[model samples]
Target: MQFYLDGYRPGDPEYRPAAPGRDESSKGAAALPDEVDVLIVGTGPAGVVLAAQLAEFPGITTRVVERRGGPLEIGQADGVACRTVEMFNAFGLAEKLVREGYWVNEATFWGPDGTRNGSTAGITRTGRVQDVADGLSEYPHVIVNQARMQEYLLEKMRTSPSRLVPEYGVEATGVEVLDDGGDYPVKVTLQREGGDTAVVRAKYVVGCDGARSAVRKSLGIELRGDARNHAWGVMDVLAVTDFPDIRLKSVVQSPAGGNLLIIPREGGYLVRFYVDLGDLDPADRDARKRFTFDSIVAAAQKALHPYTLEVKSTAWWSVYEVGQRIADRFDDVLDAERGTRTPRVFIAGDACHTHSAKAGQGMNVSMQDGFNLGWKLAAVLEGRSPESLLDTYAEERRVIAQELIDFDLRFSTMMAAHPTDPAHPELGGVDPAEKQRMFTEAGRYTAGFATEYTPGLLTRSAEHQAVATGFPVGQRFYSAPVIRLADAKPLGLGHVAQADGRWRIYAFAGAGDPTSPDSGIAQLAAFLGESEDSPVRRFTPDGADLDAVFDVRAVLQQDHRELEVEALPAFLRPVKGPFGLKDYEKVFTPDLKGGRDIFDERGIDRERGAIVVVRPDQYVAAVLPLDAHAELADFFAAFMQPAAALV
Candidate 1:
């Protein structure tokens, strides 16, 4: 799974163009068609994820445009957080990316004098901090460059049923949102690199085109935040170094040579150095123009002095002025009074928010932005949900963007100041202890785990919060190991909630009551098997494939051998494949590794079964009593098109 880029180094005779079809003109190439359902700008992490998700809907047509001629092979953001890996796992790409990248298990820290600082340099380990998300996910922080990550996603999109192919060497030069109600409400002007121009219409458009987003500018959106006073140099290099923590993720603060952030990349020999370039006037054009490979590598050498460091080869390098900014709104228009607004033109990722890439979140958060928006957009486009559901995308993600900016603002300043600078009296310059505490605390948010959304049409009241105390409303559902009752194979509950874009209902059947017909689990199963009028049936539109829009799985607290698959109600175990010869996935048991129970891990009572509703993106939407059929039916009716209405 490890990937190697050959014959394409900078200035090489065989070097490929940054983008393909860069020399092709409209006269030679086919012009863009008049319309597409979803037109996405930029093929970065956000754009590719958006394209891939939109391809899932058969009725929707998705197209992505990138200015680059081809996918990048290296450089930029690295570090896939635990939650992001869970998302990739849900979509069937986590294992592939994990295999191709290095899993960062611990972080190391160094002080001004090149001495390790930690409680175990007798007090703490300088280069080995505790893993922040140790129990949060099965996956660890992975170090795959953004270029490679996008390539993986792009390949997935290419092989998908929709066969989505992004348009390269094409850029969005203009966007016009049509006020007149029509099938295609957005007009986008695309220009190829060779001066060929064409216009394509779309029901919706999204900008994932980095900080210099033409889409955002065309839509008149403004980014609100200030640029930092410091500049930084980042380089991906293959090097021979005597530094002991070269392989570990290390944060080194120097009193004179500037701070250095070391990130070990996929290959064991390659490392990324993020060197603080000290204070420089943002308005000084000449100073900014002086950065080069030699200057950047010199910075890295100075930061790690006394330890001989020699760069054998460099893959990529860039000088960046650190800053934080977020769009005032994710969408172009907002009309709350109408209860419906055209989410026609949108911005995400760097187009919506920009921060220093040192946190390894630029690409991760960007991909997640698409992750959060894709399902909502798909639901609306397919008439599965109302337009109002679309508004929640901006509402939920904007807050996260602002929070990220705030964190980076503080982090940039802390890292920019020298370890011995007198200006920062609070800690007498960069205090390694304080920095470690803050960095760990920030990981909770940066790792994308503890983010809780507000209650909207998707989330229900907090009254039932006690039912699944560990799985809260409007939060991504936590995972725990569970054994399949039919086979006794252990697996995490999240594996069943894969990112297939389906609403999931988990019926935790607490210690089965075969003797009582009216008991909680029995009553629920009876309702499901009764008829098409069952609450479960109401969730799906008439004539629609039941599994296409939603999934229902039972988690029973019963021993694998003791439980008979035939004894389970029809609803708990649906039949599928070749004239119903095969059973759908069987109910899972709470018992897991080390005899631990998932019910206990999630704070669910083994005697009191509960019904948990999970959104398409796997956020826990609601938790109700097992017998709350009426309430459950009403819940689906809120967003889903009723069977009667569909007919």
Candidate 2:
């Protein structure tokens, strides 16, 4: 039950290289075979991790293709967050990063000192970082170059059992889905890259090709959101400075111009700065665009105090205008106007959602998008999941993408606005109150606290759903709960569930003698009673049956709650045997977490009580909010037992 509860830390040992023969490459891109079970485009964080996850699954032919050729061979690189690193460890890339990357602990804030102000002590740090959760995770965060990571992935990928074709760029200019709805096997198309073109076929296709996603366009799906060109500078340099704040600083700033951040990496340093060329007058804008490298260096020097800052060679550098956008529908038909029919096309990374990279969440969010999707897709592909499970990927990830964009909007707005105050530049433009607010929120996001999936139904629609529900699942985060499997206890009612690892929920309430094998739920209850991962408590039949303590199912029938409850992540399993659970509430009962449900929390009472159905993923199936348990149950019965419904 404690598996992955607290993520792997510096020396926690989950980090290890792949079993060589399975991942290493065998032949050149041209020589490699063409067909596969899954073809993933783009080898960025999203693609790489996805490939890694899929490779571990048996009977799946997965491949990773990057138009840009090999890893670290090109492309500008950046840093990795704790979450990214944690994932890397899972896929066995963290150790490589740790060996080749740098560790940064703190960040600094700077502001303009004068009209041509040298610099001001705006905010002293990027923001307070999260203290490593005790026994929850090993390292809080790490700064590693993007290219280096790609290199590491390339080496590891060479041995992947999945067929990997790194340089075969997809010319998915226009593709018609041959099997639009028959489980997407053997898609036929022609591909062109490097002045070469040919026909190709694959069982599946993934669009990780980024913003100008070929798969998305081929599906004829149009992006559905706004895009803005935000100005920002990122440079990875060999700084010749003994600046004490180098390792500690996260965000650097200025008043008259944009600021710089000292990303104290192991190789050297990566500094980032924000700029706005939009409001600039024509002359200033044109002149600045054509500004020489000298001006950029000058800008850098102004922000960071130099000891002997001579420009060593630039390891990687790029200036990106930040932008934000989202797709209207997860999938669409490829008709002339908007595609005639929906294709089994899936898009991850920037293709699905794009946003300005400020808090370093772009990579993290993208990786998470892949994580939430990869396992589920594999499930569907393996025939373990209902086709409806695939739909959940879009429904869930869309909200996450929206959350990122919203955060970036607020962060970027406040970041670009220079504080009018000089004495306390860190305060931005407002008084102490606003400064405190910024710091608090910044700390929360920077610590990755704002990143967890909500416990609310874990359902797709959030409007009528509650944000938190279920027993211990999605109930608490930062550490998955520990349950005594032997005791068969409930783990998530509030004080259980952590995001670090999966959970194995059980119940000692099964029928039979507490000592009989039938009371194996008893053995499970006993084991969970001592497990150290999450809190496990036995149910009290008299007043603790949960029926008395909370009106869980009752609230549903009353339409008092609207959100669905989420099951704990599927990874959690029985410690040493097949998992088991009490029969699902043999019958929908009147018990609901008291009369206090999500809607009731808002002080809104329903005119009539109805059935509050809970879906498998823990979202409100439907809030009948009326005491019609039979009717509500019948509707769901139709959903799960279609054939039975007709009879």
Candidate 3:
């Protein structure tokens, strides 16, 4: 929340000054640009996230198009994962979402009770487990409408420096990658609402369009996977139920009746149900047509057994056959054997991978796909990083998408299976306890904390991992609480990271006093600030803020009150902004009052200290010794271009 850097005038500091030609009056009426640095297809979670992130970089021209006439109002995906919530914090949208969405704390499992003496068996609460494991994330798993989430992201783009607004009533018809090495190598054919069509050229194109993506089709990529014949009907309804765990996230399984997954929605009165519609016949051409909203409600009531459900209103409902599919490749690199071919067009979200919704991973992972690709695209477009950096998007995200598909297959199978059916002993039944255990163990992945990228251009080798064991290389940097040295404000170290496309270097002070010249922090700061070949000096443009390309911060072992801000190194408190005011938020200390010692919690060695390099998307790139300056320089040189080269 740093502000007033440009010598603020008065009104909302958060309000970004509009770009040169983008005024409020020209919002939707403005014609589509014939050329753009990046062109995005679809306005789903993935597309909106990419647009929101690119909007931060006003220097690059980014445009988004959707086939719909306007914003999404209802019916798509819900369930925002903990990791997605952390990402939203970077855009300053986490608090509002948490306040508006329903927080899922515990999940209860219900199974048929054999002890009941009634003609119809009753369901009994078998097990209750926490939705997210302890300390998995500071944020909670939330359930909100997908439309509301897009609206928030859209608002962020509207307020950003780029003043980005999606062009509705327009759809991408064709895509072609030109062989000529020109500025805009990708040509896109767009069809407007009427019969009119136009052509636009872009340096890069991202397909966030759903399962049936036209962009993916243009690339000649095929989704290869198996469809399990299981059918499920999902609906968001306003209902009154006698079920005890109606408000809580609950799973009900009946031997004869179908299974139901009940998730309470945001408004407290609304709840979403995924009702098992049984297996569909292979010969049936339109299985979904046979099931209506009333049939789905009846199936849900049957699954609840003794409990009853009276649906007053149906908000949204759809029937879907369980299918886990993923594209063969996520990029336009058709012939990978041809070495060193840079990808010009990419696909993300449902365009890349899709699975059942019961796992609540479709929207969560889709947003992450955009987050992973957005910063890389921005860096290359701004000439800050080489074009080769774009190659890592497909390599990394494709693996993650595959993993999600695998997990969904296992989870969906268990949910669809009957619980210990004696008559059909050949069909192995899913035990209630075993189901609960699977859910508990899969918390980390579902919460979005378990994704780890392999060593590549971005992720460095874990040679110095022992120095900082908690912040593993190639994984999202786990946040910890720390007190700001300047104002003594308590906050998470990761919260300081915004989606502004800048690298983060956290220098932990060694055993010696940080103010002493002999300490590692002081030496490292001097090297980064004075050395000619240091990453900060080589990549940062001339006359720009010293922390513009790389934000260097220090965390000392001593309390904030005991340390003097003036004694810290120049790099720790660089002067910036039009007024040249000294920035004081770079230095931090452990929160003693909160009993959070980051050094102990994250296993940072206090005697030797360590340096953590985090990517713009908040993933830890490398962990090195305090004096590993050469390795640090080489890491950035692998992708980042020198400022002089850009000039």
Candidate 4:
């Protein structure tokens, strides 16, 4: 496999494991056909990101499977959004996307008469202004097309010493997971390019296929969602339209027809126009199938002006509608009861939560599925987190899917709307905020940055640690800052922090710096980067966020807001002392708990005493204080990597 991922073309006269139950030898290493620590079963954003993350662990033997002709090595339209920028930075692909991509800082939405009703801040905040989307995820919110991203990921996977060689394109099919109330290894069946069947077995099998995943169905796990019979043809055309005009008109409706979108993409402006394939109307079902590109163009021309529609081919295009968010149930993963977690046959990405893109969350949310599921899988593959931790995937992600579905529901209503106008007839409802939330949320779902974890194995029996009025306390926020007050440099702490960042314990020195010499800590007082700090996300003292968690009000007493104490508890505040920004000890109280811990003793350590177990992706997995180490190993035993499975 060492030479295979070294940019090898894959097909050889003698080597062929592209069949079911087939095995191959590479780098003088011999293993079973199914022996692998982590087996990824797709190569899209989710699959590729998972492979890249697992590839970071040397002991884990990682393998990636794609059903396409390798990574899409060329740029194409579709699957692009302004919210994926953070993930790009995490995966070290930010620079490429930012340089070659467009920084859609300001997007204007106009009413019928060029009256801009809504505004979206461009993704970029200008030179060295801390890219609003940086460190948010493994990728960024730029339009680089699928091929560009795939090529970059494929190249990185190739250079990985612990190579996760992309294997067997779509030729590979069928994955069977064998589990009987205990641990059941995964068996995957693959059909080579030439009708040969190969089977590869592994400890874990991840399904990254699209919504219609065969692996998901094989597990009998029915994804509960609306499989509406609606067909929407996407146009990746090259034509300059009066997009600048839409700065005033959010929805363009003419006598001819109404086009939904007027987006200016990289190559050209992409005007999203809808065609009634009549899939939704049983009466028009037959007529819908006959709908063609010319029909798509005809409808678009009616709404758009100064445009000659020349279809420049489509990419990753599909036709589907509003789906639900509910999964089968805990019984699906375990027994009838949610007690003994037995859920196997993991399904991530679109396969798990398929929804209408009317909310502009298809690509953004799909990638988030990967971010949510990536680390736990890596931990299980690395022998660090627990198998019970795997249950969190559904617990946390299910909530996200539910929210996304709701967002889509609102968007569907908005898109089907005509501006409500009493003065003029063409106008219907003017409500755009409900509709705008989708894009903004798409821009700031803050998936990887979102820290709220629904009660699962990790948060089981977690009691809130009371903070004092003086201690530098952070409440339940996604991430806290490692403010180096010495130079006043406030380090952005996402799940994935940069160099000089392994495990940063944000303790306090007690002494508040009016103007700390250190720029690092000084910068910490600056704006908390969460999508331009809009009003929709206003953080009050009572709001559950970093301020409420860390209780930073004492430092900037006036401007800072902390939750109004029911009784002004003394425990939630920051400890006071001459906090030397220079010394880690002087600044960070060693005893201060990061709230959630993997093995922290409950009583021995104060309420604020807990350790944070951050995955390589930078997310807190199991947070416990001292004395819970046993559970840590158990957690790792079930969730972390398999010791025997690792290379």
Candidate 5:
């Protein structure tokens, strides 16, 4: 939210000033570039997010091409996780999305009343629980159309300095990785509607074209998993229902009929239902053809039992068989043990993983995949980091994709299973109460907050976990209320982060006054600001803003009113922008007005203090002591390149 440094624009400050020769007017008027730093395939959640992130860096030449004629209008995935909302906030789109989307606060469960003649009776309310656990995230689990989500991201890209716009009606037909070391090492072949083809060279390629990705086929990667043989009919409809929990997310289990999952859409009148269509016969290839929209409605009517549903109109409906699959690898390097080779091609979203959508993780996880890889790609292409930094994309995201598939398999199985049958002892059945418990427990995972990257080049070991217990080294940086020392404005500490391809170093003050020259924070700030080997001094380009490559900020233990902003170290209040304006929003204190002490809430050691380093994507990369200046420099040295070297 820092602004007015570039002589004050009248419009929104979030809209960055357009780069030279790059603006909304240039979109589509300029011919396609023969070469680009990155070429992304598909306009889905993954590709759009990646393109949006790259748009922030005008120096990076990025292009996104899609097979579709235009933007997605309707009929696709919804159900946005809380973590995804946090990412949207980083891109400055969360506010609009939350205002438009439906918040899922509670969920109710329904099951048959009692066993009758080896079957269940009429359905009855079983249990009700909170949809997302308290304190999991500041953002709520939202239900919005995937098309709308992409529209917001695309808008961000269009308004960015690069004015990035996807080239529609042109699709990637093939990909080939080159052996010789050149600026553009990957070749991509694209085809238009009229059968005209063109070839483009790129430094890197990302395939987000979905389950039947042609780029993935070019790489010869196989999606390895099994189909559950169960089929479910999903539909978005405007309907009148006697079911009390129609607005609330509900799971209905009927032994005599089949299972049903009801989710209310963003609009108050629209709702979506995943009606169980029973097990699919392996031998029958045309089983899905036999079930139509009318059959889906009939199945929903039966599943509700005594309750009734009068459908007014159907917005979108489809039949899908339950299946869980993940690609063998996400990058171009096939054999890891052979030799050191940087990845030039990658796959994300449904292009790399496929699973049942019952867990509401498809779109959420897919967007995260793009977020995880976007910054790394930008850094490498800008010469801020080495090409080896690209390897971590596959290493980290592949594990998360596998975990999603495993969880989805278990969750979809429970939702599809029938209630217990007393007469049929041989056939195992799902207990209604147990199913409810599982749903409540899986909230963290489904909300996208449970992902933790393993220790690697990007993440540090938990040896310093005692420094900042709340900000785990390998997980997303958790936010807490903080008051701006300069303006007394209250906001989340994590809200300061923007997807601008810069690292974050949060220096929490110890018990001693941070203004004192002898305090731990003062000494640490001096080292980071003045030392020759400090990451800030070495990685930042000559004459650039002091916080250009690394955004260093401080959090004090005392109230903002008690502290003097002028007395803080220069690094904590660095001069930036073309006008050399002193950035005042960098310093923060505990949110006294909100009655929350960040140190106490996040388990920060007030006596010792801590430094939490967060990546561009908002994941905590390292947690260290306030005076661990050497460790801080060493951590960044592993990945970041010295600015002088690029010159």
Candidate 6:
């Protein structure tokens, strides 16, 4: 028998773990694989997160390419919404962000010409901005640079079981969809740093290559939208200032200078400023040059007339033109064959949509765009879902992109307008309340919590509306605390709905006897536990790990003490992990004695509870009466092959 470390040769007796992120290729690292399950272009936040997600699936292999040498240093798109934070927590990435970022809970507003000479009078007012995401999740908005965000995601990918590495200094020149119908359908041509080109094949290709996407262009997808003709100068600065709201998330409207959106960064002293660079002709090269670092800082100082402004140092800066555009389609196939659409090519993040970064949504929404597509691709490639499942990526994400564009058009128009500016007549005479309402209303959309998919496969039920709680179908399931019956551990329902690629079936088994013939839990246990041709058995691949395909959990209304592992149904008991470790958290109940009531919060009835199905992406797929096992089977059958058929 022989044992060796990753970097050691056969003769080496000692073993040492390879250094993190070392370019092992220079030290005998293997060359890139000839084929992969997924080929991701552009190592931006979206591409990296997508790769990280695909890593969760044991059989899915991913190869990512970046035109740049490495991660970006700075360019202000740094606000992580509360909903995005909750997603990070589900993936165990929230703590890292919390430690490296600052939270913005309240926003301050300075208006009606507060600036006098270079300093402002005492801060006029502060508004509770955090309320926008209140009740949506326990997490709050975080501010971290896009670069750091990518680094964190990349670190996670490197440590993942897949150990995927993003190939830098490599550009994807072209992609062609093949009609051969073999497993790999997309052929991509890669241009290395030395001007050498190589071709690789992949089952699917995802373009996260930003606004100027080569893949999207190659697909002939037209991005539709009108240019807003609005341009803004953004800069990050560490400074000394008398401006009271300098440290807060603020909208400052100067009487003479212009409008400025201020965002405080992670380190206490660092601040980002978004300055309205009044309408310059698109052909005006001289005016464009004026949109520089020194010029932007001067504009900021003028905006805060009486507030003493001093730029100690600048971390980064840029001038971006505001516009609203979305690609016509997110996923597409180059050639039509045999009446079937091969959605072998897809685009996400900035490749699909682009808008002002003022809302802190660019990176958040981009990463989520990848998140949505990642699992769907993984499931289809692994044979857990049909090819048609990929169609929903375009259907669901295009709607979101359109909505985001619409929201940004309205919000940006308002932000770019000064009360005295005649160019934006709509916002010229708007009052403070109306302005605040606009911010808050748009905040809801920007938070990313309001995103809801139309009912489709998985989300085939409309019964959620009739439930006591207003939990809607085709939406991400909200969180409510419940106690694990076995160990009495308090856990948030949303936290348990991790983004691991698996369907989660939560059976709300209302209080009843363990063996009662009419009890929903008893009936469920009976139906799901059958060894031959069971409902669950018909939903996954043959001989596949059942727990990996479906995460079955029970929310019982009974007292915790009355239900033991041995007393419950076979399917409702603790499942053994890979190492034979027992996972007792699968069954939960409201801690009535502790005054926590999840059933009430989720609108689930204790008398006749519901069975809720959540997709791998954590979207609520279906909600039905507990005994509707047939409907659940149908939901799976819509996209999956039966186990017996697989044999």
- Residue 137 of model 2 has an lDDT of 38
lDDT of 1 by residue, 364-450 (tens): 788889998999888887777777777778878898888788877887777776664344567657577677777787777667775
TM-score for each predicted model, relative to the true structure: 0.90, 0.64, 0.98, 0.64, 0.97, 0.90
Better of 1 and 5 by TM-score: 5
**lDDT digits (tens) for residues 356-436 of candidate 6:** 988777788888888888888887877767778887787788888888888788888888766443345555555445667
lDDT of each: 0.76, 0.47, 0.90, 0.46, 0.90, 0.75
Off by over 4 Å in 6: 1-30, 114-123, 126-133, 283-289, 334-339, 420-427, 468-470, 514-517, 531-535, 574-582, 643-647
Q: How many collisions between residues are there in candidate 2?
A: 101
Summing lDDT over every window of 10 consecutive residues in candidate 6, give the lowest-scoring window: 21-30
Q: Report the CA-based lDDT of candidate 1 relative to the real structure.
A: 0.76
Q: Which residue runs does candidate 1 get wrong by more than 4 Å?
A: 1-32, 114-127, 335-340, 421-427, 514-516, 529-535, 643-647
lDDT of 4 by residue, 1-647 (tens): 11232133656522323222222222212122457766777777677766666655545666776667656654433334544555555666666777876444443432333332223211111111122254343334444566676666665555454544677454337766565412336677877666767787776777777667666766667777654555555554455443444222133333223435443445444433443232466466554456667766666654443334555655333333434555553113644545465444577777777666544566666666676666666555444445666777777777767777766666555555543444574555543443344434544442323334554554432432322221111212234343322233343334234211122223211223323433222333232223233111232222222221122221121111221222121222222323311122112111112332111212213333333343333334444432343443344333333232211
Candidate 3 deviant stretches above 4 angstroms: 26-30, 422-427, 644-647
lDDT of 5 by residue, 28-101 (tens): 61246899888999999999999999988888888899999999998488999999999999998889989999
Candidates 3 and 6 compared by lDDT, better number = 3
Candidate 2 C-alpha lDDT tens digits along 374-482: 7655655554334455555666677778878888777766655544665666674633234335644565454443554443323222332222222212211222222
| Two-way TM-score contest, 5 vs 6, winner | 5
What are the runs in model 4 whose C-alpha is more than 4 Å off? 1-32, 73-83, 113-141, 170-172, 179-184, 243-256, 267-279, 283-288, 305-326, 329-338, 421-451, 459-505, 512-647
